[model samples]
Target: MKYTHTMPFGAAVHDNGVRFTFWAPDTALIALERNGLAAAPMTRDADGWHRLDVPDARAGDRYQFRLPDGHLVPDPASRSNPDDVHAASEVVDPQAYDWKDAEWRGRPWTEAVIYELHIGTFTPEGTFVAAQRRLADLVALGITVIEILPVADFPGARGWGYDGVLLFAPTAPYGTPDELKALVDAAHGLGLMVLMDVVYNHFGPEGNYLHAGSPSFFNAAHQTPWGSAINYDGDSSRTVRDFFVHNALYWVEEFRCDGLRMDAVHAIRDDSSPDIVEEICAALRDGPGRERQIHIVLENDANGAHYLERGADGRPLTATAQWNDDLHHAAHVLVTGDTDGYYADYADDPVAQFGLALAQGFVYQGQASVFRDGEHRGEKSDQLPLAAFVSFLQTHDQVGNRAFGDRIDALADPAPLRAAYACLLLSPHAPMLFMGEEYAASTPFLYFCDFGPELAAAVSDGRRAEFGKFAAFGDEAARARIPDPNAASTFEASKLKWEEREQSPHREFMAHIAQLLAIRHRALVPRLAGQPRGGRHWRDGEALRVEWPLANGATLQLLAHFGTQKASGIRQLAGQAIYTDGITTDLNDTLSMAPGSVCITLQEDNTHG
Candidate 1:
């Protein structure tokens, strides 16, 4: 089957010829330059858009726009940039690739066990084809969804995709657009849903030519950490908003992606009634979402829960769910006892907060955050479904943002970390794993990027300097020990050593996780839809208790003791034991949960009988 999203922007290939659409509202003069050949003058309409109808132009042709200043710039809406961001844009026929997963309707959000990965660091080849070859491995690990880091074309040979500058085109460093499509097709055939990460908050520091053509794309009044926030609500912002809305659609329809996970949405500054996020979700729900399950998750640090509100029909009003940073933060504090930056917010009694997260979604829930200087954070999330929050022990931000990018395995004891893993995966919340987490790989997921010499040095120096507040990196010599992000070795060090899975400790951990996922798929997954909201979580000191009512009139119970010693006076839980880790015993009608242990049981509601 064939799929194509018809957007007003970008080059559209017709049977007769190609029709080019360029939106440079501020520019008066422009022309189309194809294949480094003679330039063809374009006609500018009243809205500052230029159009060029070329009868001979066809797919696979390279093109760029010539500004009035005599400078050439690639199209912002390019489908594929084979050469790189600074080079020519390739005209791609989205309908050319024949999709084999035409019948892939997609799995429900309740079934999501997200496995987030960076394409460049996921496999040795760091290409789409290599990643495709590893799809069955993820499926074998029981990952229902694969969330890819942003693939939008960015400058340089290697980097985390968050720095992507091109909003539409897939990076050339990965395979061609067709190869990417094949990967998505292969994933769907394996019952895996692929989700792309998109950044609409701010463009990268390099290779953004919109200012040279469409100067109004950035709003000067609102600033972000990356720079000026995107012009989402200012004057001439309709076209800017359309650019991103169509981007979401293009990925789902043209690329046949299952959905998107918008990066750092809290950084986006949009003041309109129906915000950009809402508009994007509405577009999807009205468009392709009507047919298949197309999810829109978010990485909003602000902890906004309103966006995850469901309609009267129990369908998501806007976003499907958001990354539950609160859960990760609490788990980190509880396991590693690391109180730095945002982790400081969860330092005091993190076990209670962790329980709240497992039972009631986000723990903050409109509470004052100490790390935010007494500022209130998050909305009430107790009423939301457990699956509305994507839970994880680690993410790109959780690990990569660190000074050394140490995984949780390197931070805490093996027993506590094992218990934490059980807490994360066995919970009703949608769980996600950073690449290679299932195997307990020893590699660190460091922050690495390749930029020009000037920007590269600045980024490297700034990266080392940012950890100055930490006592470990207070000295200049100590700070210098941090790996340089621009170094090729740094990027190579972040790649997963796939063969490590056959080793002793790694193989043992992999088997444990596989067993947990097997039980989850057999017991929890089929009954997830019955859970309308989060469960009840309470804790007495380090001993935590959580319970959820499932569809079969069974109460799923979890008893965990995070203390260094055994905890007594625990009420005995009745039901079939689903899984157990560590030493848990029952004596004289009382339960004694050993230190760093977790127990899962199901109590069927058959007392009346």
Candidate 2:
């Protein structure tokens, strides 16, 4: 049933039927075209909205909108697209699906273990229903939340959902609305929270007809890689903001999505005029289901706390979580010792990297960025709960954006990889694992797009040009690095081999992740309580140690050795050896980490026993 814009969008199905109302101001005419029923043109109200009181429209009947040109299209505001990816939208009766999660309390950000995955490459079937069956596996793995990549309809049936054109419609390839619901239900049953990634920064190049209808949806004042930035502060922004707000609510209320991990929030350029994010948050929290909690996570490079701040009214409008790139950079540089691109600012100082990330939010806070040559900085994480900083050594972007999707497992020495994993997972920040990383899957996460030959060529060329701004690779090398976006082999090679979990080093890595997860669950549980109680000590050029104190009065100390070779000058404290990779402490009670080796706790009291 269509609900007017002035009136909050609500639905109720009676024996007589449902009444649908839509707000389309730019349209010359609007019609409600139901399946197998005579078409009825909706009369426009004073506010430019059209309302059709459909007495015959059943709860589950399919419908579409007939534009002024007699061109029928799927409803842009449709709650559910039931006819699969490329078919007509259905009139979803939101109450039709029986939700067993009435008593299902939502998970807090502090307790969240987010698993980011691409739907296309997540499983063998590569569909929502197929992914649903594996929720138990995630639940078994001690994952509290599953963050699915962007699902908005992109160009083809198979693609990374970030390049979406149909922002309103869920990708037809993922599954039907009911199927999505089933997946969410399954996740809920498994006690796993679901966070769907939503892209609002810019629309893809193709299938974006929003401009043809209304150019005001974007503004030229800000340009982004994807396209013109969204018209967040420009003309007709109220309606634009409403559109995205509705999209956010649709996922949570209709599809049972628990949260939204907003992709590239930094790209969402908005002026001082009518704070966009605040309004969006207001719209989501204003609905009938007042008591239900919905989480919002943002991916930003700035590491600014402004996005996490409340409104003038003191309302908590901050994102529930944000990706901590500093943590990734520190771990990447410390473990790999590769100082190319942004990594230039972050090598030879694991203590500085680890301590600052644990203390301040970013390592290069207010420092001149070697890559950009400008001042780049971040907020201090000391005031924020450790969980607020989402830590990950490897994510899809880190791996897939590379010349090849080479994971840490592909590196020569497994010891450094293992040490890096230990440092990342055992740290104070909330940890995230890339798919197949737990098992050290050897398959690469190559960049695969579903574009045709022409677009594929453009993508390859564009990728090389973009990376050329930072690194100097030959044209042939760059082109060779760009996988054919349209090739089936590209996507095929990206899939994780679940069977690898049983293999040699894969099994060993899995054991490590499992054990680390257990330790995190037991010791780190209290850190999720929104209290940031962590201590750190770092010598500017030598060593840095960060400590997370547990409720049991025990401490989880992370000592990082920055030198390439083991430093044996510091004193050694004799304690029950918990973890070490042939790395020992120095003469002055300082641990000499062998290049990438991480030594755990050491106390003289334990040695006396």
Candidate 3:
């Protein structure tokens, strides 16, 4: 029997059978072991790749690889792991699913109003099919893009997908591979571009079989906080690099995803020329991604400006944008007034820092990090376009990593939260919101996992120790109150309460968001899509003034007061008031704003008001 190979690796399905390919340079012997059948030896090439074609194998058939030591292991590039990560891999035909998004060309980064969500906690059913049913709700909420948390297979049914093991397979707990595709197709049908979060930094602690197949997969010299770093510059690095690049293409081409949000790219250590990230981005741009625009975003804690730098041709070097922690930290400190841990740096003159973050891509660019003992951090990003930064008030890490997994609304005053939301949505940069952020759902987004007893104890102890550094969680009793990651109730509690959207404050908040988004799409976004021609920001006592030159020969002005008392003596000279929240309604030469108020106005002239 013969099988046509579509991918360089993995289980490719054809009419006759499936073709299996594995790259195991360290292993001498390899065999294909199908369920309820004898093991068949596979032929190995000089490059250390083992291949075998089995005509009897079909879609839904379970199989594993037999090593020389007689140990059976799942495919390193399995497409579908119907069972747990430790179980056998199942064959899946990528062409079996009929998609209905033929006319869907993805939206650009400038028009993206990203909504990040975890499937398990997003819906009560916690399945891709269930989540698909709620796409219309998100579409109605003014979300142009959906950035889903990682969906790769993990050890158990529930976990924040950063700990995913099987890179190619969508977690079985969510739904079948085809069902996940359906979700993406449905989103495209509703004019929503879907982007998946892919983890290339490290694999989960459990169910990792890469070392068993090839020890060269990990670099022994470099050590990450999670474990040994991946071999991006060491021996046999070409194949190692290809594995990740191929995975990126697999998601884009097979799943019909518009983009990928690479998770924790700062943790990915690569010293070779033409860095792995650059290579991956180049591949995406040159491969199937060439047909449609694919936006690639990075989560880099290092604030590496090179990722957003443009070449001589004026094209970006690597990613389309990066998550701006500087913006989030400054905003969090200003609103919540929590000056512990990393937030300590922004404690001093947080308003000024927030203004800088809005004007520049990062406030810490080439500056000393007070939280790191005055160590210099971040590269200069002032020259980059505003679209190169992703600004958000709340994200999965910011909320779930908290001692009690509290959202911004839970920690800050209501007025300030509203002010913050207005600033976030109307800012020049791209903005993202957490799952229930639009309606302010009451459910907590906690960190929950389903590890075994031994690993669970270690994780629980480590989680407590991590928060112990904060003064608020220093008390042992407070630490004990933290939810256990292994508990089923912890995962259940994180599920969003969709019914709360009809409540009082929640419904009001939804209306506010809708109005903000309408103004953004109808007025601001069209004029400020890529970058602002010029911008200025200043701290006026407890209030902040931000001004940007619009593409239209007009000046956009935003005045926000974060102090408790009303801001008086503000001159009311403006063309049109686009948005005003919690401000005094006296039309005079002098304007007074209530505490935690924001006012945005567009003046035809460039003169200061």
lDDT per model, in order? Answer: 0.89, 0.68, 0.86
Which lDDT tens digits does candidate 1 get at residues 14-127?
998999999988988889999888888999999988999999999999999999888899999999988788989999998899999979999999899999999999999999
TM-score of each: 0.98, 0.86, 0.96
| Off by more than 4 A, model 3 | 1-5, 311-315, 530-534, 585-588, 603-609
The TM-score leader among the candidates is: 1
lDDT of 2 by residue, 1-609 (tens): 122122233223556787766556666677877885667888787655677777877767787667777666665555556553334566666555666666665765667777888888888888888898778877777788888888887766577788876665667777766677788878888878888899888887665655554466788888887668888887667777777877777787767778788888777888844466656556665662366667777788877666665444433465666788887877777667677878877765654775677654556545667677776666654555555667888888889887767886674355666766777676667788888777878889988777656787788678767666654455566556666666788898898777787888788778878887876676556544534444565652344455654333445666555555665554342334455565664556654556656665633223222
Candidates ranked, most accurate by TM-score first: 1, 3, 2
lDDT tens string, model 3, 38-128?
Answer: 9999989988899999887888889999889888889989998888898899988877788887777687677889999999999999999
**Candidate 1 vs candidate 2: which has greater TM-score?**
1
| Alpha carbon lDDT at 275, candidate 3 | 87
| TM-score pick, better of 1 and 3 | 1
TM-score of 3: 0.96
When sorted by lDDT, best at the front, the candidate numbers are 1, 3, 2
- Per-candidate Cα RMSD to the true structure, in Å, reads 1.5, 4.5, 2.8
